[model samples]
Structure formats: C-alpha cells, structure tokens
Target chain A: MKVIVIGGDGYCGWATALHLSNQGYDVGILDNLSRRYWDSKLGVDTLTPIAPIQKRIKRWQELTGKTIDLFVGDITDYSFLSQTLRQFEPEAIVHFGEQRSAPYSMIDREHAVFTQVNNVVGTLNILYAMKEDFPEAHLVKLGTMGEYGTPNIDIEEGYITIEHNGRKDTLPYPKQPGSFYHLSKVHDSHNIHFACKIWGLRATDLNQGVVYGVLTEETGMDEMLINRLDYDGVFGTALNRFCIQAAIGHPLTVYGKGGQTRGFLDIRDTVRCIDIAIKNPAEEGKFRVFNQFTELFSIKDLAEMVQKAGQAIGLKVEIDNLDNPRVELDEHYFNAKNTKLLDLGLQPHYLSDSLLDSLLNFAEKYKGRVDKEQILPTVSWHRK
Target chain B: MKVIVIGGDGYCGWATALHLSNQGYDVGILDNLSRRYWDSKLGVDTLTPIAPIQKRIKRWQELTGKTIDLFVGDITDYSFLSQTLRQFEPEAIVHFGEQRSAPYSMIDREHAVFTQVNNVVGTLNILYAMKEDFPEAHLVKLGTMGEYGTPNIDIEEGYITIEHNGRKDTLPYPKQPGSFYHLSKVHDSHNIHFACKIWGLRATDLNQGVVYGVLTEETGMDEMLINRLDYDGVFGTALNRFCIQAAIGHPLTVYGKGGQTRGFLDIRDTVRCIDIAIKNPAEEGKFRVFNQFTELFSIKDLAEMVQKAGQAIGLKVEIDNLDNPRVELDEHYFNAKNTKLLDLGLQPHYLSDSLLDSLLNFAEKYKGRVDKEQILPTVSWHRK
Candidate 1:
C-alpha cells in the first residue's frame, strides 16, 4: 500500500517514514521543512546531527534498497497539497505536519497565532484534499494525550460512553488541551471527525503521549540517518531532558511539585503504533481513536529514574523543583486505557533503566552541543 | 464600557452593535466585509436591500446620535486585530465574525478551507489579541446550536456531568457539529476554553441557535440601517427560506423526511442574549457557555407554519420534500437545555403567527428582489 508522510523531515515523521520504507510500503514524504526553519528561528539546533531530507532519503535508499519519494511544500497551501496528493495518491496518509511544541506556541502572540494557523489550517487542508481527490485514503493523524489535559477520570481510548439522564450514547472524549499547540490538535480532531461524518472519509486520530529515546531501528542504521533530538526547553520531552541533564551534570529540573503525571512511550513504540494503525485502517466513515502510550510517569518519577541511571553510570545527578511555567494541575489522576492498540497486537516497550542509559550515552556524545541556557523554561504561561 | 463588534456588518452582528450602542455602550465594528464579498462571489444578494457599512453606520449615527466605530480589515490578520483592540480597549468583544453558512462551507473544497480558515483563524486572532492587550476583556463569542448536532439524549447547557465507572465529572458537552461551519465553532469553543483556562481570560460562548427575523428595533430604524436578510440557498435559514417561498409564490422546500429538529431564536433575542452575556460576564479564567435559543422546531414544523401563515395572507403555499443534499439524520431525537440564557433574563421572542406574519410582510416588501433560482439547495453535502 502506498503511504505519504506529511512533515516527513521532523523527528517522528522522519523516523516513521524510514520505518514504513523498511516495512516495504510504497513510502513518500511531503514536507515544507518548517521544523528546521523553526529551529533556525529559535537559534537552537538539535543535539543529534541529522541529515537533510534529500541526503536522508538517499542514504535510506542506499542502505535498504528502498526509494522513498519526497515532495517539499507547505500542506497549508491547498494547491501544493492537492498536487502532491494527486501525484502520490496514497491509500493512507500519516499527518505529523504541525507546530508541535507547547512552549514554542506559548512564546508570544505571534507564536500562538502561527501555531494555530499552521496546525489547524494545515490539517483542514489535508481533510479537504482527501475529500476532493482521495476520499478512499485513510488519514492517520497524530493527536496528543495533552489534548485530554489530565482529566480526573480515566481517559478512554478516543471516546467515552456517557449515560446522561438515563440515555446512553458514546461520544468523542471531552478535550481540555493545555496549550495552543495541543488545542490545535483538539481542533484538528473535531474537524476530522466532522469530515468523516459528512464525507465518509476514514481517519484514525492517534492520541499519542510524550515520546522518548533517540534511536529507532532505522535511525540506528547509520550516523547520517539519525533522528533529531530536541533537548531544548521548548521541544524536548521531560524524560529526554532529564536524561540529557544527567549526562551533562545539570540538575534535573522538575516543574512545581513534579507530580504532573503523563502517559509516555518510546520513539520506537510510536513508529510501531503508526504502523499498526496503518495496517489496521479505520472502517469507511469511521473516526477511530487509539491511545498510543506504553507507560505513565510523573516528572519526579522520570527524574528519579534518570538519577538512578546516572548513578549506574558512575555520575552524580541532582534534581531541582522549579516553579511551573504552564498552567496545569501539579498533581492529577492519569490512568488512560491503551488496550485498543495492544488489542491490535502492539507489543509494548516500557521505559527501562537500560533505555535510559542508552539515551544518556547518546547525550554524552553530544555534551558539547547541550546549551545549558536552553534547558530551563523561559516562557511563562502566566502573563505579567 | 467600550465594546467591539467583530463582523458587525453581518446579520446578527449589525443588530447587536446597534442594540448595544443604543443602550449607551461605546460600540465599534470591526469587519472585513467578507460576507458582502461572499454574496458577490456566490452571485447572490440579501433579499433585503442593505446599505454598505459606511452608510449604515452613518445612518445609525444620524438617527440615534450614537457613533459606532468601524474598522474594515480581516480579523485573521493579527496586526489588524491587535491594532483594533489596542485602539478600542474594549471591556467586551462580541465576536460574530465567521463564515456562518453551512451550505456555503460544503460547496467545494475551496469553500470548506475558506470557512474553516476564516472562522477558526479569525477567532484565534481575537483570543491572542485579548490575551496580549485586553486580558480582562469579556469575549462574547457567537457559537451555534449546530455545534450540538441533533443528538440522542438531553443536551446540557455547554457541559454535561457524566457518571462513568462510578465517578462523576462535568465536562464540556460532547459536540457532534453537522457542518464545516459548525465544526469551526466547536474548534473555537475548544481554543477559547483553553485560552481562558491557561491565560485567565474571561469568555462566554453563546451557543446560539438559527436566528430568524429580518427586523429588530434597531434595524427597523431606517432602510439604510436595515440588517441584511439572506434568503438564498447558501445563507438563508429554513424558516426564512419558507417565508420567502410564501412571499414569492413558490414551494416550501423541505429536505428529505424533514424531521431534523433544531433550536432557534429570533434575531431580536440574539441581540438581547449578547447584551445579557456582556452585562453578566464570565468570571476570570472561566469559559462559561449558554445555549442561546428560545425554542426548538423541526424542518417540517417550520414548513407547516409558513404554509399556515401563507394561508392567512390568501397566498397558496405548496410543500415539497426534496432529496436531502446534506448527509445528516433526517429523523432524530433532540432535547437541549437552554435555561441559562433565560435565567440571565433573556425574554425570548418565541415564534408566533404574529411574528411569522411580520417576517412574511417584510419578505413581501422585497419579493421583487428575491432570486427564486437561488432559493433551492445548490450545494450537496454528499460528494459527487
């Protein structure tokens, strides 16, 4: 089956693209390379050295004897997106094209607006393109668990059955996103659901959790094919940041009380989740949702795990509690059901000390590139 | 109190601006005049001959000695919106600026993108502007009842308490919006709710129903100040279309089984509800929602009413059930709670034969201007 990965130059997108190519799917990538441009704008570079899309695709072709086609343009541009869709005509489209950073989105009004327009408009364009050209294409959209925003109840996979006043009906799980970035995902989910309802367009919204680890099997193939590792205050996940902090002898910064628990998964697991979703497409006119995470941990839990991992490596690691920059519950119940993907034969990879050590080793290799100033939160969610 | 009426040249926006201005609030209108542009693009016009913004505002000023400031620019443009907000420094911003037509939204892929981008981006710009410049401003956003697409079970006012697995929590009511236009409203509600939560911004999402009626006390002041009455396939509501059909001696065109029930209110009630939302503002960081409609009616009920009203005026009106161009439940149970607005002291103008006669009389006055060819459903929700 033919598949197109939008935003294929970004970290997860690139990893997923390579993985799908390795799986012998006819893979193609369409990206505007905006993430790289954003890194340039923020004066931050990925800790991991990553090749250009052209070189990365060429390397993958040489390494695996698989040619992944590349189309570079903004998905927000309908003409370009439709043209790309017409040319590729994939049976499935994996959408990872979005401004995917809460901190980056909350940096300022400009950043906030840019995040909304880029993410929401880009997703809407994809829906429109599918309706107009490839109505049969299944959209595997990467939503975030952040879209659920640490609700008190156990998070259902994609929807919840509500018995209101003796009448029972199931509906999309109520969203309470924490930031402009996550809010955009919620918006995308709504639009995609509506489009599916009206147009019979098949879509699966993957409510993915925080992804950690640097080396996917495809990325570990070569030095040049490595995925970008963002260890900045903006784009980096807490676990990844904690591991890097330990490697660089910086105190692991925990926001507030560090009781903000969240679902998490390895980068490899994200790839596998996407693969499972693609392989098991949503039925026609169905907007399926799967909670894509292998484990749940709080900031303190992650910090302690990193510290333990550091101790094993003969390194001293300390933890510091900082005032929370984002407005969220410091402590909350976060038990999300992830049985759908598991039921679909997903072998979970829980975070382990061995995994932490590998990530620390990778961070140690790039210790010189770790900018300490970018490690602490700079943008405050509260306006002064 | 200074109030900025975004999209103030449109139907509900114009009347609300005038009503607020009449009530002695300093009112300003910020519109891109996109609705006018859309009418031109669609080769249709409002059944009622409406004057341009300049003339309308001038007429209001001339008659009532109240000046409403006008800012002619797109709200999607952040700079323009911020500039308007800074100048106005509004205590309340009434947001009615959106592509409000479902049929127009479903016309084509381009139309769908335009509607989503115009509505969602415009609302996002307003949120960011408020966060940046007027954090204390009470945003009175005109959400639609269509956001709660005819669902089984009782639709609570903006939220529902779900008792799941022996635990109960109140969440924003599960939305099943029917159209791209309504879906954009759902997206706005999510984004606005997030903005209020994180930024301590105060907002009230008025989930207004389909507004009918051509004349408000403010709009009835002068011909130039008259609100635009859309009676076309794309922009007109079913009741208004039926009234026009009666006025022009045409069939009361119903779609399919015509059992699609929906909440509705008079244009006068819409203006009054906006006033109530502004007067009793949502608290800081609270995203309060009110289902703003006076009554509920099905398509067949509206058609029958129009037929009876036509009979009262000695005009023989025929009823015809055309194939449903939209993919929606032709028959569904719809029970929605709307007591919040009533509790806020919104004395609703319930649909009565007298009210129907008034609207029919107004339609008869512009019967010559009514484009009979534009009355039927032109845009099919089903993709061909």
Candidate 2:
C-alpha cells in the first residue's frame, strides 16, 4: 500500500510518516514546511531540538533502509497539489496540513481570516483534486474534538440519530465549535461529506482529541529523527504544558476553575490510529468518522497528576489559577463516545502510565531551551 | 434609523434597499457591482431590462424624494469594508452580498473555490468589522433555506431540541447543504453565531426560500428602478424560468421527475422580511434565526401552475422533463417550520394569487430580451 502524509514535517505527521515507512508501506512526505515558518514568525520553538525535514528523513533512511519521497508545496495551490498527487499516485492520503492553533486564529481579525481561508480553501482544493483525479484514493482527514464544543448531549462519533418531533434520521452531529480554527474543521467536514455523497469519493474524518507526549516508536529510534514537542501557550496542550512547568520551577497555570474536561491521547496512539484508519478504508461513496482518543481528563485532574509525578521524582510543583483566556464553560458535561477506533483493533496508550518517561524526563533535559515568557496565555478570546 | 445595505445592487439587495429608503430610514448601498460583471462573464442577461445601479438610485430619489447613499467597494477587502462602515455609522447592516447561484458555483473547481472564498471571506470581514467598530449594530444576514438540504425529519427554524439518550438540548440544526454555494452560507452562519457569542454582537440569520418575482413596490415605481430578473440556467429560479419559457413559447424545462420540493416566497416578501427583522433586532450576544418563507412547492407543481397561468393569459405552454444536471434527490420529504416570520406579522404573497400579475405579464412584456442559448443547464454536478 502507498500512503502520503501531507503535513509530514510537523509533529504528528512526521511520526506517522516514519511509523508507516517502518511498517514497510511505500511512504511519501508532502509538506510546505509552514510549521517551521510559523514557529519563526511567532518567535517560538519546540521544546525538543529537532533536525530539519531532509535531515530527519535521511537519518531514518540510513537507519531503516526505507526511502520516503518528499514533495514541498502548498495544498491551497491547486496546480501544485494536483501535480504532486499525480506524481505520487498514492492509495491513501493523510491530511494534517492546516493552521492548527486556536490562539493563533483568535489573535486578531487578520489572523482569524487567514486561519479560516487557509484551512477551508486548502481542504476544498484537495476535495476537488480527489474528485477530478483520484476518486479511488482514500482521504484520512484530521479533524478536532474542539468542533463539538461542550454540548449537553453525549457526542457521537460524527453523527447521531436525532428523534425530532417523533421522526428519526441519522444526521451529521450538530457542531458548536468554540474558535475560528475549530469552525474551519467543521466547514471541512461538511464539504468533504458533500463531495463523498455527490462524487463517490471515500473519506474518513478522524475527529482527534488533544495529543500529548513527544516520542513515537520510530522517532525514539534515533535523536536525529526526533519529533517536535511544542510547549508554548499557543500550540501546547494542557498535559504537555503542565509537565514542562513541573520540570522547571514554573507554576502550572490553570485557567479559571480548571474543570473543563476533554478527551486526550499520546502521540504514539495518534500514529497508530491513523494506521488503523488507513488499513480499514471507508467504502467508495461513503464518509466515515471515528473519535480518536483513548482516555479523558479535566485540566484540574491533569495538573494534580503532573504534580504527583514531579513530587515522586523530587521536584517542587505548584498550581496557580488564572482568569480563563477562552470563552468556554469552565464546568460542563462532556461524555463523548470514542469506541469506534477501539473497535477497529487500536490498542491505546494511557497518559498516566508513561508520564515520567514520555514527557517529564524530556522536559528536564530541555529545560535550558524553555522560554518562560511563552508559558502564560497571551491571546484572549474577548475583543479588547 | 440608519441602515447600510451591502450588495445593494443585486436582486434582493436592490429591492430591499429601495423599500427601506422609502420607509423613512436613512439608507446607504455598498456594492462591488459584481452581479453585472458575472452576467457579462457568463454571456447571459436578465429577462427584465434594468438600468445601471446609479441610474436606478437616481430615479428612486427623483420619485420618492428620498436619498439613498451609494458606496462602491468589495466587502472582501477588510480595509475598504471597515472604512465604509465607519463612514456610514449604520445602526443596522443588511448583508445580501454573496455569490448566490448553485450552478455557478459548480461550474468547475475554479468557480467552486471562488464562490466559497468570496462568500466566506466577505462575511468574516463584516463580523470582524462589527466587533472592532460597531458592536451595537444589528446584522441582518441573508442566508438560504437551501442550507438545510431536504432531510427526512421535519426541519425546525435554525435550531432543534433533540431528545437523544435521555438528554435534551437545543442546538443549531444539522446542515446537509447540496452545493458549494449553500455550504458557504452554512459556514457564514457558524461564523456569525460564534461572533455573536464571543463579542456580544447581535445577528439575525434569515434562512430564506427561493424568491420568485421581479418587482417590489419600490422597484416598480419607474422603468429605471426596475429590479433585475435572471432567466439563465446559471442564475434563474424554477418558477421564474418557467414563466419566462411560457412567455417565449419555449418548453418549460423540469429536471428529472421534478419532485424536488422546496420553500419559496415572492420578491415583495423578501424585502418585507428584511424590514421585519431590522425592526426587531436580535438582542446583544444573541444569534437569532428565522425561517423566512411563506409557502412550499415541488418543481412539477410550479411548472404546472405556470402552464395554467400561461393558458389563461392566451399563451400555449408545454412542460419538458430534462435529465437532472445536479445530483440531488428528485423526491424527498421537505416539511420545514416557517412560522417565525408569520408570527412577526409577515403578510405573504401566495404564488397562486400573484402568478399572473407579478410574473407572467412581466415576462411576456420582456419576451424579446430572452436569450434562448442560455436556457439549458451548462454545468453538471459530476466531474468529467
């Protein structure tokens, strides 16, 4: 089987590409390297030192004797995307190429507009390219759990059977996304569903949860092939940020009541879930969805867990409460169904089991590179 | 009261702008004149001969002795839109500015990309401008009923309370839009909802049905003030196209079995609905929605009604069933809730009552202007 990771230079994409290549599938990496560009633009860097894309790929090839093809261009450019797809002609395409930070989107009007237009138009171009040339290829698009917000009802995978006024029909789940970046994902899901229905295209939308930890099996094989670990306020997840704070003497900044709950998974499981989705493709003319997460945690719970782990390793960690920068429910009912991926032969990874080895140790080693100014939230959801 | 009608040169916008101006409100029209440009690009003309927007505004002032300010600029340009809004200082902004044709959107990849980007970006710029400069202004955005692709269950207004798994919550209605154009409207709805939630902004999304007539009370005041009527396959509605075909002695083209049912109203009612929404603005931090149609009809029923009306007016009419160019259900249950506007004192004009005076007679008078070459569908939903 042939697969292309469209954001193969980024964290999850790099790990997934390396894992798939190690699994003996012909792999190709297609990225514009915008993830690095954004880091430079924002004056931030990944907590872990990582090599360039070419160097990472070269080191992997030397160690594993596998050649991963590379295509460097923007997906929003139709001619470039279509030409790249035609040149590679893969059976499956994993799309993680999007402006992914919610804070970056909410910074101002210009950033918000750029985030939406870039994400929505990029996905639209890929859909059109698939309909025109690669109708048979399967699209494994990465969506986010943020698209669901904090609805009162139990969130289904991608759809729900709504019994409205005594009539029942399964419909796309109602989305109340909280940010412009998440709203873009909701738009992409709708667009992809329409394309599948009309043009007989196949797609599997992986509505993934917050990904934590840094090392995947392939990335851990060599330091030169290490994955990027973001610890800044803009791009970092709660668990990762907390672990980093514990490693140094910085306080774990908990926004508001810290009762906001969400689903989460390790980076290793993200790669595995992508593999499982690609192995079991949706039928032609079908749009499938899976909630890709193994466990759930509230911000308060993760803070306490990180505190205990740091104390066990002889580190003093304090938790501080601050006003929430985001306009979201501090406490809400959030029981989302994530059994679809589990049913499809995905052995999960738990954050509690690997906290010290996967996160804390790495953060302690990279304490010199941690920029303390990036630890506090800088972007507020409310307009000034 | 101060009002700014965006895209006020287009069909619905022109009618609504004149109606508001005549009702003792200070009205300003901000348009890019892209509607006329698109007609030239497609090599199609409106069935009704209309004067230029400047001439139309001038004639309205002459007849009513009321001035409507004109501001020519694209809403997609943030700086241009923000400057115009600042200059106008509108208390209410009526947004009817969008690429409104489904077939035009599906012409090809370029068209699809253009439609979504134009509509979404333009609407985003408005929301941001509202947040930055005019937080107190009310936004009366023109959305389409087509945003809710015919579902099996009865469609609620913009939200439905679903009883699922012993839980209940009123959420935004699930959307299954059929085309890129409709999807763009759905995207705007989501974006607007988010803006209202986070910024304490007020917005009312009018999910309007197909608007069928060429003249409103204000537009019929003089020959120069006449509203444009589209009769080409790319821009024409079914009832308008049927009336035009009857006038020219051409066959009424009904796609497939013509069982595709939809909601519809008169062009007069469209202007009236905008007035009603503006009078009763949504509260700050609230996103209100109203189903803005009065009646429903299947395609076959509309064609048959045109046939009967044409015979009574001494014209021979024939109905022709053509293969559907767009991929949609020919027969589907389409019971939608539209009582919100009625409860708000909207006196609707029925198609049966106005078929002769409102549509057929006008089409007959303009029969010489019909372009036969533009009658049949030029775009297909399926990619070749």
Candidate 3:
C-alpha cells in the first residue's frame, strides 16, 4: 500500500515515516520544515541532535534499502499540496503539518495568528484536495487529546453518546481546548467532520495524547536518524522535561499543585498507531475518531517516577513547585477512554522504570546541549 | 457608550451601526469593504441599489447629525485592528466582520479557503487584540444559527445539559455546521470560548438566524442609507429570494422538498438583539451565548408566504421546486430554544401579511435591477 506523510520532517512525523518505510509501504514525505525554523526563531535547539532531512532519508535508505520519497513544501500552498497528492496517488495520507506548540502560539498575536492560519487553513487545504483529487484516499489526521479539556465526564474516543430528554444521540466529544493550538485542532476536527458529511469523504482523526521518549525502533538504527528531544518550556512534554531535569541533577519543576493529569504514550506507540490507522481505513462518508494514548499520569505521579529513576541511577533529585504559568484547573477529573488503538492490535509501550533509565542515560549524553534558560517557563498564560 | 462596529458596511453591520448611533452610542465603523469586492467579483449587484459607502455615511451624518467614524482596513492586520481599538477606546465591539455566505463558501476550494481564512483568522485577531489593548471591552460576535445543523434532539442556546449514566453536565451545545461558512463560525465560537477561559475576556456570541426584511427604523430615514438587499444565489436568504422572485414575476424557487426548517428573525430584531447584548454584557471570563432568532419556518412555508403576498399585490406568483443544490436533510426535526434573546427583552418582529406585503412592495420597486440568473441556485454542494 502507498502512504504519504505530510509533516514527515518533525519528531513524530520523521519517526512514523521510518516506521512505515520499514513495513514495506511506499512512503513519501511532504514537509515545510517549519519546526526547524521555529527552533531557530526561539533560539532553542533540541537536546538530541537530529540530522537534516536529506541525510535522515539517506541513512534510512542505507540501513533498510528502502527508498522514502521526500517533497519539501508548505501544505498551505494548494498547488504544491494538490500536485503532491496527484503524483503520489497514495491510498492513505497522514497529516501532521501544523504549528504544534501551545506556548509558541500563546507567545504573541503574530504567533497565535500564524498557528491558527497554518494549522486550520493547512488542514482545510488537505480536505479540499482529497475531495477534488483523491476521494478514495483515507485521511488520517493527528488531532490532540487536549481538544477535550478537563471535562467532568469521561472523555470517550472522539465521540460521546449523550442521552438528553430521554433521547440518545452520539456527537463529537465536547471540545474545550485550553490553548489556542488545541483550539486549532478543534477547528480541524469540526471542518473535517463537515467535509465528510457533505462530500462523502473518509477520514480517521487520531486524538493522540502527549508523547514522551526520543528513540524509536527506526531512530535507534543509526546516530544520524535520531529524533528530536525538546526539553524547552515551549515544546517539551511534561514527562520529557522532568526526565531531562532529573538527568542534570536539577529539580523537577512541577507547575501549580502538580495535579494536572493527562494521557501519555511512548514514541514507539505513536508510530505503531499510525500503522494501525492506515491498515484499518475508515469507511466512505465516515469521520472516525480514536483516542490514541496508552496510559495516564498526573504531574505529581511523573515527578515521583522521575525521582525514583534518578535515585536508582545514584543521582540526587528533588521536586520543586512553581507557580503555574497556565490558567488551568490544578486539580480536575480526567478519565479518557483509549481502547480503540488496543483493539486494533497496538501493543503499547508504557513508561516503565527501565525506559526512564534509558531516557535519563540518553539525556546525560546531551547534558552539555541543554540550555538552562529554556528549561523554565517564560511565557505566562496571563498577561502582565 | 463608546462602541466600535466592525464590518459596518455590510447588511447587518450597517443597520446595527445606525441603530446604535440613533440610540446615542458613540459608534465607529471599521471595514475593509470586502463585500463590495465580492459583489464585483460575482458580477452581481444588490437588488436595492446601495449608494457608495461614503455617500451613505454622509447622508446619515447629514440627517441625524451623528458622526460615525470610519476606518477602512482589514481586521486580520493586527496593527490596524489594535490601532482602531486603541483610538476608539470602545466599551463594546460588535464583530460582523466575516465571510457570511454558505453557498459562496461551497462554490469551490478557493472560496472555501478564503471564507475560513477571513472569518476564523479575523476573529482570532480580535481575541488577541482584546487581550493586548482592550482587555475590558465586551465583544459581541455575530454567529449563525446554521452552526447547529438539524439534530435529533432539541438544541439549546449555546449549551446543553445532558444526563448520562445518572450524571448530568452542561456542555457547549454540540455544533454540527453544514457549510464551510458556518463551520468558520463554529471555529470562532470555540476560539472565543478558549480566550475567555484562559484570559478572563468577556464575550457574547449571538448565534443569529436568517435575518429577513430590508428596512430598519434607521435605514428608512433616507434613500442613500438603505441597507443592501441581496437576491443573488450566493448571499441571498431563502425568504428574501422568494420575495424578490415573486416581485420580479418569477416563480418562488424552492430547492428539493423545501422541507429544510430554519429559525429566522427580521432585520430589525437583529439590531435590537445587538443592543440587548451590549446592554447585558457577559461576565468576565464568560463566553455567553444567546440564540438570536424569533421564528421557525421551512422553505416551503416561506415560499407560500411570498406567494400569498404577491397575489395580494395583484401579481401571479408560482412556486417551483428545483433539485437541491446543497447536500442537506430534506426533512428534519428542528426544535431550537431561542428564549435567551426573548428574555433579554427582544420584542421580535413576526412575519405578518403586512410585513410580507411591505417587503414585496419594496422589492417590486427595484425588480428591474434583479438579475434573473442570480435568483437560481448556481453552486452545488455536491462534487462535479
């Protein structure tokens, strides 16, 4: 089967691209490399040194003897996007090309506007391109688990069956995104669902949670094929930041009461979930949604886990509480259903102590690259 | 009270600006004049000949001695929007600045893109500008009833209280918008809701229904100040088009079974609702929603009403059923609660025979300007 990955240059996208190529699918990557540009603009580099796109592709081909096609262009450009879709003629398209940092989006009006335009408009182009050129192709879009904020009710996989006034109907889970970036994802979900309803398009929206870990099966093959590890306040996941802090003997910075609970998964599982979604295509006229995370952890829980891992490695680790930069519930109910991917035969790699030790050891190697200035929260959700 | 009316050259905006000015509010208009550009691009003019914007403003000032300040610029430009907000120091901002036609949005990919970009990004800019420059201003956004597509259950104002598994929770009403234009409104609602949540900004999203009628109390003052009456396929509402068709000795063209029910109000009620919203400001950190319509009618009901009105005026009006150009439910249950606006003291203008006759007589005076080709549905929601 042929598959095209729209944002195949970033962390998850690059890892997924290698995973799919190894599985013997004809893989083509289309990316604008905006993530790299964002890094330069913010003066923050990844903890792990990621090779350039051309070199990564070359190394992947060298290791596995698989040719992964590359097309570097913006998906917001319709001519470029449509031409790529027409030339590739893929049966499945994985879209991850978006401005994905909530902090970056919240930094200023310009960044917020860029995030909205790049994410929502870029996804809209894909929907139209599918409707006009590639109707048969299955669109597997990466939505965020953040779309369903901290609602009191259990977060169902993409939808909820609400019984109101003695009548039952299933609707897309109520979206209460906490940040502008997540709001953009909410917009994409609504737009994609509408396109399916009106045009009979097939789509699978994977509302994935925060992903941790840097080394995937494909990325571990060579030094040059390494995935990015963002330990900065802007792009780092909570667990990843804690692990990095733990490695350097710095305090695990816990925001607020350390009570913000969220679902999480390993980088390996993210690639595996993409494979599962591609193999199990949504039916025509359907916009399928899947909650794509393996386990849940509170900030306190992850902090303790990192402390334990650091002590096991004979390093002293402490936990520090900081004022929460974001305006969110310090303590809230968060139970999400994530059984869809498991039902599709995804063997999730939970955050084990051994995995934490491995990640800590990896972070130790990149300790010199860690910018201490980027480790703390700089952008407050509230205006000064 | 100082108020800024964005997009104050268009149908609802112009009327609301005049209404507020007559009520002694300091009203300023900021518009990019994109509506006029759209009219030129579509090669269609308003059935009622609209004077140039300068002339309309001049006439309003000459008659009422009210100076409505005008700023011609795009709201998407953050600098221009911020400058206007700073200069006006508006206590309230009415946002009607959006691409507001469903059929125009469905014409092609370009239109779909333009509609989403203009509407969603423009709204986002407002949210950011409020946070940065005008933190205390109340934002009154004009949403559409079409944001909630006909559902199996009854629709609430902006939220629904659902009882599931012996637990009840009130969530934002599930939005299932039909067209790209309505979807843009949904995006705006979500964004504004998020902004309120995180930034403590105040907003009122008026999910307005199809506004019929042309003359408001203010628009009736002078010929140059007449509001636009669009009878074209792209921008015209069903009731307005039916009345125009009857006036021009053409059949009232109802699409398909003409059983598509929608909530509606007069142009006068729209202005009244805006006034009510401004008077009743949403609480800080609250995204208040009000259903802004007074009556419900199907296409067939509207066509029959126009037919009777035409016959009363000694004109033979026939009803013709054309194949539906849009992909929608021909017959569906639509029970929407519009009590919020009523509770806000909106004395609605019902569609009486006198009212219908008045509209038809008004349309008849400009029947020669109505292009027969513009009356028919040209853009199909279905793929070619």
- A1-384 per-residue lDDT for model 3 (tens digits): 999999999989999999999998999999999999999989998999989999999998888899998999999999999998899898999998998888988898778778988998899899999998888899999999999998887888888887767566788788889888998999999999988888899999999999999898899999999999999999987888999998888899999999999999999999999999999999998999999899999999999999999999998999999999988898988889998889989998988988999999999999999989999888888866
Q: Which stretches of candidate 2 lie over 4 Å from their true place?
A: none
User: Which rank order by DockQ, best down to worst?
Assistant: 2, 1, 3
Of the two candidates 2 and 3, the one with more favorable lDDT, higher being better, is 2
Write one digit per residue (lDDT tens) for candidate 3, span B1-384: 999999999999999999999999999999999999999999988988888888898999999899999999999888899898899899999999999999999988899889998998899899888988888889999998898898778888889876655556688888899899999999999999988888889999999989999999999998999999998889988898888889889888899999999999999999999999999999998999998999999999889888887898899999999999998998988888999878878898998998898899999899988788878889998865
lDDT of 1 by residue, B41-96 (tens): 88999998899999999999899888999999999888888987898789999999
Which one is best on lDDT? Answer: 2
Pairs that clash in candidate 2: none
Between candidates 1 and 3, the one scoring higher on lDDT is 3
List, for all models, the DockQ compared with the true complex: 0.71, 0.86, 0.71
Interface RMSD of 2: 0.8
> Per-residue error at B77 for model 3, in Å?
1.6
The reply for model 1, stretches above 4 Å from the true place, is none
Q: After TM-score superposition, what is the CA distance of residue A320 in candidate 1 from its true location, in Å?
A: 1.4
Q: Give the alpha-carbon lDDT of every model.
A: 0.90, 0.92, 0.91
